[model samples]
Every structure is written in C-alpha cells, then in structure tokens.
Target chain A: EAGVTQSPTHLIKTRGQQVTLRCSPISGHTSVYWYQQALGLGLQFLLWYDEGEERNRGNFPPRFSGRQFPNYSSELNVNALELEDSALYLCASSIRDRGPEQYFGPGTRLTVT
Target chain B: AQSVTQLDSHVSVSEGTPVLLRCNYSSSYSPSLFWYVQHPNKGLQLLLKYTSAATLVKGINGFEAEFKKSETSFHLTKPSAHMSDAAEYFCVVTGERTGRRALTFGSGTRLQVQP
Candidate 1:
C-alpha cells in the first residue's frame, strides 16, 4: 500500500502571504496529523484531524489550521505567514483505532522571505 | 502531557558496529513509543514501536527497541550498522491520558556511519 503523500515538495512565499499544504493518507487510515519541523525548533505538532473532525492541536497559533476531507486527505493552511513559518511541514496518518504509530510523508518545505 | 528526549544530538559509528540511540519519554499514563528514521531529503520511516504488548519490539531494517517502563526509556538499537543507516532518528510519544492524538517528538539524533 502507498504511504502518506504530500504535494508541492517545495514552496517559496513572502511575508504576509498565505500558504496551503496538502497531504493524502494511506488507504484505510482515518487519522491525519500535521507537524512543523523548523530549523532550531525541531519537530512540533500542528494539528490532528480524525474522521473529519478537528481532534487536537498544539501550541501553534490560530494562523496554523487544517482540515481533513472525507477521503482522509488533509490540507494545512497558514495565514499571514512570517519568516519563522518557513519550515518543513510534514503530514502523518494512522488507523485511529489501532494505536498511535504514524506513517509520515516526504513533507512540504515552505520558505518564507 | 507527553514529551520525548533524544539523549544524543549526533552519534558516529563505524560500519559493522553496533548502533544505539537513546530516548527517554515522559507521560502521565502508559505511552505508545516509536522510532522514526529520516534520510536526507526523504520522509520519516517507522523503525519500531512499543505499545505495552511486547517489551522488546523489532521493526524493519534490523532495528529494535526495548521498552523499560521503570526507566521510562525506549532505546533503539541495531546489531550491525550499515552505510544506509546514516540518517536522523526521532523518538516520539503519545498517551491516551492526554485525551489527544497529537504526538510529541524528540529533538532527533543524527546518525553517521563511517566506512
């Protein structure tokens, strides 16, 4: 089976611009999660969507939001982006009922100037 | 709350040598632990996971992790290192106690294998 897949492997945007990153979960997976891997910041959870509902989110600001579609694919949106928002955004998927183990995508690298 | 700490920021080993990546986790309740490896410009790959079923969990690519509940540790190990094993490894943790599915990841440890 195919693992999680992400789109727009690399993106370049300017400050104050909005960006959207996409992810498609593996077949039969119901949970989609978003994470930001920024330089010096390490990896931090951004959002979690399960069964098309927003289940949880991390310490990130409201500017970082996302949603999961009926097919379990997800899209992360960043509004009024700042230079600090430039980082590799990763999406992961897992079977909600199974456990917490997640499979990650190649990630979308966003560079904000 | 849940968190993970990777003891080493970087580790260098010679080919055919044993590999050890230390990880410590904190959770209010029983936790699900995982080891993920990422190659340069590649996605993260699951190395192993511990879910209270087995203390010793074996994963893909000859990697394994032993969960020590008393120590709150889940350390990944490989008997023999290969050049392909050079990558950044992350330790992750999540628990039902948090009532959230978001995972806490470590700072990550970069492994370097020398020929």
Candidate 2:
C-alpha cells in the first residue's frame, strides 16, 4: 500500500505571506497529525485530526492552523508567516483504533524569507 | 505531562560494531514508545515501538528496543552497525491527557558509522 503523501515538496514565501501545505493519509487510516521539524528544535507536534475533527494541538501560535477533509486528507495553513516559520512540515497518519504507530510522509519544506 | 529525552546528540561507531541509542521518558501513565530513523533528505521511518505488550520489541532492519518501566527508559540497539544505519534517530512518547493523545519527541541523536 502507498504511504502518506505530501504536496509541493518545497514551498517558498516571504514574511507576512500565507502558506498552505497539504497531506494525504494512507488508505484505511483515520487519524492525521502535523508536526514541525525546525532546525535545532526537533519534531514538534502541530495539530491532530481524527475522523474529520480537530482532536488536539501543540504549543504553536494561532497563526498555525489546519483542517481535515472528509477524505481524511489535511491542510496546514500558516498565516502571516515569519522567517522562523521556515521548517520541514511532516504529516503522519495511522488507524485511530490501533495505537500510536503512525506512518509519515516525505514532508513539505517551507522556507520563509 | 509527558516528555522524552535522547541522551546523546551524536554517536560514532565503526562498521560491524554494536549500536546503542539511549532514550528516557517521563509519563504519568503507561506510555507508548517509538523509535524513528530519518535519513538525509528523507522521511521518518519507524524502527520500533513498545505498547505494554512486550518489554523487548524488535523492529525492521535488525533494530530493537527495550522498555524498562522502572527505569523510565526505552533504548534502541542494533547488533551490528551498517553504513546505511547512519542517520538521525528520534525517541517518541505518546500519552493521553484530557481525552486527547499527543506525542512528545526527543531532540534526536545522530548516528555516524565509519567504514
């Protein structure tokens, strides 16, 4: 089976611009998670969506928001982006009932200038 | 609250030598642990996980981890290090709070294998 897939593998934007990164979960998976892997910061959880509902979030700002589609895909939107927002954004998914072993995607690298 | 810590920022070993990546976790409840490996410019791959079913869990690529509840540790190990094993390894802990499950990741340990 195909693994999780992300779009626009790389994104470039300037300060104050808005960016949207997309992810498609693996088949039969119901939970999608977003994480920010910034240099020196490790992987920080951003958002968690389950069954099309926002289940949980991390310690990020309001500018970091995302939504899940009916198809179990997800989109992370960063508003008024700052240079520090540049990082590798990863998306992971797993069967909600099964445990926390998530399958990850290649991630979308966002570079804000 | 739950947290994970990777003891080593980097470790260098020779080929055919044993590999050890240390990880410690703190959780109020029984936690689910995982080891993920990330290659250069690649996505994170699951090396192993512990979910209370087995104290010692074996994963892909000859990697394994032992979950010691008393010590609050989940350390990854490999019998022999290969050149392809050079990558960044992350230890993660998942726990539930207020009915929501969240994961806490460690800073990661970079492994370097010498020929």
True contacts kept of each: 0.85, 0.74
Candidate 1 structure quality by residue, lDDT tens digits, A1-113: 89899999999999999999999999999999999999999889889999999988899999999898999899999999999998999999999878878999999999999
Off by over 4 Å in 1: none
For all candidates in order, the CA lDDT equals: 0.93, 0.93
For model 1 the local lDDT of residue B107 reads 96
Q: What are the per-residue Cα lDDT tens digits for candidate 2 across A2-44? A: 9999998999999999999999999999999999999978899
lDDT of 1 by residue, B42-65 (tens): 889988888889899999999999
lDDT of 1 at B44: 90
Count clashing residue pairs in model 1.
Answer: 0
- Per-residue lDDT over B23-99 for candidate 2, one digit per residue giving the tens place of the 0 to 100 score: 99999887999999999988899989898898999999999999998899999999999999999999999874444
Off by over 4 Å in 2: B96-98
- List DockQ, one per candidate, in order: 0.85, 0.77
Number of the top-ranking candidate, with DockQ as the measure: 1
